[model samples]
Target chain A: MDEFYHLIDWALCLSGLIGLWFFFSRTGGPLNKAQAYMSVFREKGIYNPSYGLAIAFVYALLDIALSIVIYVWFYNDYWTDSDFGIAHLGRVILLYTIVLVSLHVFLPKIDNRHLRKTINTVDYHKMGLSMAAFVVVCVAVEYWLKRFVYGMWYGEESESILATVAVVASTAWIASSVYTSLNRYESIKNASERTLGALKTRHAPIVFLRSFVLDKPQRKGMTFDEYICSTFALNSQPIVSLSDPDDFLPTGGSIKIQSTDEEWESAINTLLMECRAVVIFEGKTVSLKTEMAKIQRFHIPHDKVFVATPPQNYRLAAWNDGKITERKYTLNYIWNDFVKALDTYGGMHGLPETDPGECMIFSFDKHWNCKAPVKKTGKDFLGYVVDQTVVHENDKCDYISLAEKLNRFELQHTQVLSKSDEKRIEKAIIKALIMSALMSLAVILLIKLLVK
Target chain B: MTPTDFQTIEESLGSLFFILVLIYYFTQLGRLRHRKKLDDTDGVKKVKKQMLWGIPVFIVLFFAMVLSSSLLL
Candidate 1:
């Protein structure tokens, strides 16, 4: 019993003495030395003291644990026989207190967040090597302290150690197995939900055209008027073409339909809501009644749709309350181009509303470049310059609509910057300075106490 | 035990320590490789940086022990 008390006292005394030595030694050493070493990797940046203290704590814990284990196994018997008392124990505890207090004060002020970030950007192999180095150093130091300064031994606990090793191995294996099983189950469940959701959203447009073949030919090849009528007959969608009554009227080519006033109103309303756009193919002479009336009924705004009505070269009388709508400019080639384009894309089986936006129109030309709007901004748009001047038809109007959608005001704002790094650096520097000063003070105090 | 015997024990212990460290290292490597998420480059760098200080301290202690018994005696 006496020997046991002696050993405890001796350990306490030795611990205190060592703690005092550590306090003094640090004061003489360079301050914020870790920050200097870290700076070599960075041009200029702050070092974080909290991060450094965390690392230091981990090392200290490992050191203390291994040292205690070694002492218990090898030095306990010898230690018991040594002569030590309460005064020694008190000194040891005091020394340790000062060291701890110093560390607490000094550890918060070093700044090195940028250096840490830079180091993190590197490859894994380099990182692994660095960690391995720390483990080696920690273990090696513990072994050395046990073998030399303490004259300790591992003793004959080989069997117990073997059992511990087995337990560790088994624990790791079990953890991995459980983790993998859980992950697989979660991923499979998520994938199933996604697939079901996608299926619910898929839809295809309804097609109404019926198949037919030309049977008997009356005049070998039908004239343009006859060709147009036959094509219209095959269209599945309900379409009514309004032609000029006075221009190029084939005497017997007129067709008639019978419908109630209510039916006509409902049809017009439905057409306005669903039909994307109308193609008004102009001719040599124009009758304004049926086409103009339909356009007004639909209330389809001018920008919402396009009229393939290229202005004629010659001035013609316009009837707005029976007077001519004053004419400004005329381009003959543009009118011919508009007529040709309408005949091509607007032939009879015009595509039903494919997407929500609008119906597209195009005309091919063998000569010079074509002008078309590429990007839309409200009323105006950026024109796509294909081959310096010729813009492709469908590609032109689509670009404008896309630009308008993208130009929403909220999307134009600049992004805010992050200040976490700067804040972190400032915190680290303050911590480091305080820690350094506290440690220095503690070390000076301890040295003074020891000599006394 | 005689100084010679102490040396033998120390040498054996040192070798055992080395072997233990090597095994632990290999185990860590296996763990990192087998991890579901691959090793993060930043984590590796951080570990390496810590080791720089940790390893040298360990090496000093290890060599000091080996020398203490034989030379200090």
Candidate 2:
């Protein structure tokens, strides 16, 4: 019986880990999954409070049924002989059902309000710390209730400490998972809002055209579009793209413009004229090729178009004939094939001879001459410029310098804030800090009093 | 060593392991921030992979420790 219990516990732990991995593997992770669920609910017009309550009640019943099955299958004999019996199990299940129902009914409403307020920004680290503090308070309360109210100590000191540790670890994991999802959802929503705002204001948003494969999450669990959005958040121009019809939930990178197959060409042509810049990531797709043709046909100013190439000579391992074989490929090789397809288009330049192991962005002059490849330098500041006059073996300029150069070309202008505007922002930030500190103090005080 | 002594050592090791896991979590968080600064996508990937394995291992070890302690008591 002990061995069976241990096996079941370990199995549960393993299954939980697998579930976590599965959730993380999704494009936007669990938050996007939740958003997709909410989207569906909204589409059916069943996103209201009454529907939420009904759904939660149904789910709670299902959960209780599953619990009963597990209990009957595994613990029927053991629990019957022990202090904990069927009645105890039933009581526990009933309590859990109530808690689960409450969570399902209320969590979305709380999350929606939280997202609305923190749409532009959310400090995930702060959220995690806050959750940890909340868990600590709950642990303290549990300890107090056991010792004073019930007048009984835990079975052993080591057991109590271990239980606390387990609780803290689980709570930390849950908090981090929730905050990560919230942050991703918030970023996507904010990007979409900004994109629409830019279009309405005629801000000439940056149009992103790339192969759908690039939308896949990389090792860092970030899509290429998400990376671009993060990298250029300060650029004052929105990054927008035509929505992938296949994507059920909008991935939070560029603002996705929904259009059918028939409308794609017209949309691209419109974007070409309206966009401040068109950035295309290196990919080999018929749709991408067609888009490139449209760019050429429109004769969009050469300086306004940019090509982003991934790191060269990236290695990938493949299992062949019961042996692992590694192969290396460069984006320049792919770029050459793409250039070949557009034989008559002279505006775009061919990739450089050298393969810079880092991702590089290239632009052309108004006269269709290939300018120097731009890569993000290790340095953060603009002053770390290497002399472009000296021809380096690996020719590249800093991405910051390239942005500044583009600014010079008046492709997109950065807004300068006035002294009054700066002061107003500073005052608002100070006020927010004081309010947050006071709120934290109040929460601590409340927890202390409750524990007492 | 006697059985009690062995149990004492095991409990101490379990406590030490718990503390070490906590430290590991903090260090991983720091490493993630550093990776973000460098825009080191590959490094970020490595850290995430470590975390995925690290978390499950910690949970398993923790459960084993708890089970042993509970049985001893």
**lDDT, residue A442, candidate 1:** 55
TM-score (all chains, Cα) for each model = 0.21, 0.41
- In candidate 1, clashing pairs total 31
DockQ of 1: 0.01
Q: Compute the interface RMSD for candidate 2.
A: 13.0
Q: For this target, which candidate reaches the highest TM-score against the unseen true structure?
A: 2
A1-452: candidate 2 lDDT, tens digit per residue: 34544655565566556545543444222223334334433443323222222333333334334434433443433333233333333433343334333333333221111112113344444543544354345445544543444333356898668866765675456446545533454445444343352232324456788766567443244555565455544333446676654342356656665555555677677666666677776665678888888887888777667666543222111101111111122233345555554333434655554433355666677666567777752221111111221122122223333223232222121122346644553353244334433443344346335634
Candidate-wise lDDT, in order: 0.32, 0.48
Note the chain A TM-score of all models in turn.
Answer: 0.22, 0.44
Q: For residues A1-452, could you state the per-residue lDDT of candidate 1 as single tens digits?
A: 34544654565566556555545443311122222223321333222222333333353343344345334443434243122122223333443444444444433333222101011222333333443344345445544554455543344578446644654454344333323322332322222112111222111111111001111111213322233334332122122221121111111111211112224333333333433333343332222223334444555443323332211211121101111212221123223433343334322122221111111222222321222312222112111111222221222122223223222311121211137755654464455445544554454456445644
